[model samples]
Target: MTDIIETYLEDFGPALSGTISEHLEKSLGISAAAARKRVSRASGNIRRLGYVTFARKARFMYLENQFGSPLYWRKLVDALFSTNSAYGYAIAALIQREGFVPEWEFPIVCGAPIKQSRHLSPATIMQRLKEAGLLQTIQVNGLGDCICIVQSEEHYNSLAADTRVRLITENILLLAVKDWLRKLGIVSFDKVTIRSSTHAPKVGTFVWDLTAPSYLGCLIKTGKDKKVKPGFVAADVYLGDTITEPGSRPFINKCKTLRALRNVGPCMQIFIANRYEKEAFSLLKQNGIMPATPESLFGEDVAKGLSELTSVLHDAASHSLDPERFERLFAALGKIEGAANQLRGTLFEYIAAEVARKNYSSLVRMNQIYKNQSGKKAEADVVIITDNISVRFIECKGYSPRGIIPDTEVRRWLQHNVPVIYKAVKVHPDWQNLDIKFEFWTTGILSDEAIAMIKTAQVSTKATRYSLGFKLNQDVYDLCKSTKDKGLITAFEKHYLPPY
Candidate 1:
């Protein structure tokens, strides 16, 4: 650890505004700007600060603090980490032990930004420390961010005043996992992957929300744009250096509006969620958040867009379709609308993702596009139009083309039209191996009968056109594998049964 950072940590306590920079420069005689820039990463949570960039920006990033009281993160964070390889761990630990209190603090350190390399990684080092049993989780307020402080005595005997120096450095290797490794042109089938940096990080990409008082998230994507702006989409992403072991979903369910924008089609591309596009754009411009040019923000009119989508589906009632087909789309739209209303704030993304994951297409005033080179406008329950000759959708329970469309539904429906809209569409003989034909997907996750129906479908024009099946990609795990919260798991297992 640098002597400057060590001394600075001694003098520093919880932070707020320019107090951090001002105090550091005054005491250390360094440039004030450098101090502010350094300290923000070393101590602040970008989600709470609204300015410090950590990772992708989204409605969650923008609105995470709106509904809940800020966590008194010091206790929880303190309990979860121990000063080991960190630059100022010993000094900071001493100051914390002294119970130093800075008056009128705004929890800046809890929500600080980052601009450091591996040896200086604040977040990564902490997670690794926790995993190595150097940290412990304690519920301080009985149930809040004010959880317990470090279990100092737990490992006191395990350490010495002078432990092996090389061994200490070995503990810091996990910090490297926190660094974003840039890979250019990882995929050549389409556009290149992009990544945003700690400053002005992009939103709606994969993010890591640290459920603590110093709550911040690590926004990750494929491209090399290092700013946190909203309205972006990508898939096949996991969190960075999580406390959980490797291969877990490193993302939280962004809100409904953003959820509406993600297209988990067969290709699994295009993940968007930042309030609404227009609002996000203006906010980004106003906040000096630079996205990779042509950024789309979330619209403020999500509700209206949803209503219009339903009306279009309602219009389908009179189009060239069978009574059963009409019934399916109509019912599906109603459920989505109902689900949208029932979950106005939280889990909108979860519901939407579940719906999309179960089926690729929907019947709502869905943004239609050519599903393949065959020029067929794909439909949905969960619809996926892929570059490889295939197009598909799911049919959920009680949803059909002839169901009721609700009124006054708020929230903008995402424009989920496949990229090659109105272009040559290809169809595959089989969905996993479609040889070029329209693929109709309907509900299958709910019943064995539904899946069975798909296996015995007729392919001629005289057929029902839509099929039923329960097919999931290899990446989809039981969501259970992703979380390790004992209390949450216990509660879920105690009551709800897992879906087979």
Candidate 2:
């Protein structure tokens, strides 16, 4: 019984009294009263179950050893995330890592489009987190309202101020680089994998302060005349005032890793810091890494703005507010927020692209926009042209592995996007002779009604000019692993795989 309860707590994270009884009754096929009694016994036995009481009424159940360790909060938050939706985990991870997030920007950071709502609204996510005792909404001195982790004052301040500043500075640098890439019009994959400081840096790995994979040329162009090359641009940011030779060991080692990966493609590696010693800069330059300052990468004005903004935001998170400084920082706020939002909400599209790139050596495009005669436009998340004889249009949905894709979305895809793209392709001079295959791909399940809608469309279109199909989480995983690319597999596991 103890082992069973321990396993349950480990898998589900800390649970309240009522939730514990509910799970026990279901798992053991026992009465509610019996389950409650068992919980009472185990919770009392300090040798087995560790329980914490909040407000003298709400009890949280967990393994005894994890209650107050340094990793306690991270583990608990992660466990809770595992049981929730993908968006839930994404939002939680972002907030917990940052330690403080502004209330207004929370939605945007969670991939919500400007002036539009995602499948899960920001308010709903916040409420859920509050109910789980993971976060709270509070007013900062000048930031209005901010969302922060729920912990004692001591635990919250235990993280060194320098470490906190470093985390925030790195995040700022990543956003600045992303904005720079977007301005250059070469951001192939909108989603970026930002580094987290929760663990020691791994050598010989692709993880960096910022990673954005982009194409060098136009993606919309077709036929034999068009040339598009794919590569990844990665950067590492140092927060210290200046990097001396001895202090540059970590960055130098990371540059070595990036050099080793150059054979993978034409990747651009950047080392960003406030300043670098002459010898250190020379070493980085000799390593084929672009050693730059925030001012050099982004103009001096923008760099100064970012530096001030980072300082102000860190101060705000630490309960020090400067309304005047915070207000002045808004000059560059729009671009930064847009860049961060762009870096999210498209994980699945990139995943689908990987599957196609591995399966076909022909022309593959992402975020392709097509127009009809009347100038109406539609965008396909991913497009692949194989042998110049078959064209595949893939629509990707980045939903939670445990969530369901809505029937309305499915209906719209089948009724609107498919027919429009099919007509557009059939009339295009470049694709006149190619067969069409339209596939709906998602990292989630489809309800029975939604499946029926898709199946009906599939059969009705069977004899038509284009074929229709779909790929769920398991289907995607099977195809991703089939590619035998370790990077692709790791991405699938991180973004698409079910926690269980």
Candidate 3:
């Protein structure tokens, strides 16, 4: 009976109407009217047995038995609901090729685009899944517009724990890199771009995660002819609290990733978040991997110089009208010996702050770190508090050669950082009532798509409370050009201001 039903369905495809009866009659050597009765009986039996479903109104057959389990159905739903047909097929193929596990661990599987025909947004995909009894979505605050999908309530709790650990560990890795760069006199928060493969464009890019043969680091170097030469660096960032066992599956996967990265380049470093992960360190060392803590990245003199430089900047922020202190700080930064690019980033932040202080009524604070009630912290590059109690939270990005900021970076700031700022404002007693605004101040050209996304995000419920502004390359140049200080203007033009 199952074979006959399967054969009939296979001949006519998932949806059957007159074609099923016509094919059955020809194949079974039966009269057309008799074959029609058999078709009805077979469909009824299949539906009663709960192996397949027949939609009466739609007159379509759906093979529910093809999906072995709810997990399998979930995978099919993910593929069917992808952004476009091609992208959907690609995701489905990837799942098939990679063998979907309960804990898939791929970033693309969670946040990839949904089919346009369904008119579903990423935020609403889980609701549709829940209606189908495939998955449930759980809202998690402070995680910034995230969705958690699970097969069951018990699975949701287990996955949520894993997700939180992953997020915290990733955040630690980002903060650690920023701290290391700051200690080395690199101050621009946008110098390093952290992106997952799921967010990358579809063409010529492979999915990358903590356990992938991804382009972990690509540092651009100026050749002898002054042309740009890109160099790849292999680095593994691991937080001890997240991955405790040196012999665990995750650790093994990371080792495999590192091996693949090493095949492409010889220069590699292992960055451990906790110094007490001695077993992990030993494992790396045994495998000939060089491990370094953030503190050990710089010399004592360089560390001391950075400390003094921080003090000078703080003094300038506090005493913006003090020309002598400003000059001294600028001169010290110029004289400090290090990577030119790193110094350029540091100079960009300071000049941005200086420009803001000169133009605004007063600098309430610059480079201040704020934490929300949920304990999510964000550092604002510059904050201007007007006489009317209006506050501006500015984000500065220094991308040299212009027009290099990708759409992913713009989306990251909007979807993630904007919420952080919103929450920070909500929790602060003094700033809660003030008219707040956000400005993306960059020395790089903004793409039209990025600008549009920003405009849309500004009015979105996630950021509707604050007004949005943009300060692009041209704006920065104009702001710097207005200053009468020739030396300061020249320095700004050379480092922070982009050419026309």
Over 286-361, each residue of candidate 2 has an lDDT whose tens digit, in order, gives 8777888888977877688767756764554433444345445545543574432222234456667767877764
Better of 1 and 2 by lDDT: 2
Among all windows of 10 consecutive residues in model 3, the one with the lowest summed lDDT is 203-212
> What C-alpha lDDT values do all the predictions have?
0.27, 0.61, 0.48
List the candidate 3 regions with Cα displacement exceeding 4 Å: 1-338, 401-403, 459-464, 498-500
Top candidate by lDDT: 2
RMSD of 1: 23.3
Which structure is stronger by TM-score: 2 or 3?
3
The C-alpha TM-scores of every prediction are 0.20, 0.35, 0.38
Tens-digit lDDT track for model 1 on 219-252?
3233346643222223321111111210111111
Q: Local error of candidate 2 at 418, Å?
A: 0.7
TM-score of 2: 0.35
> Residue 200 error for model 2, in Å?
43
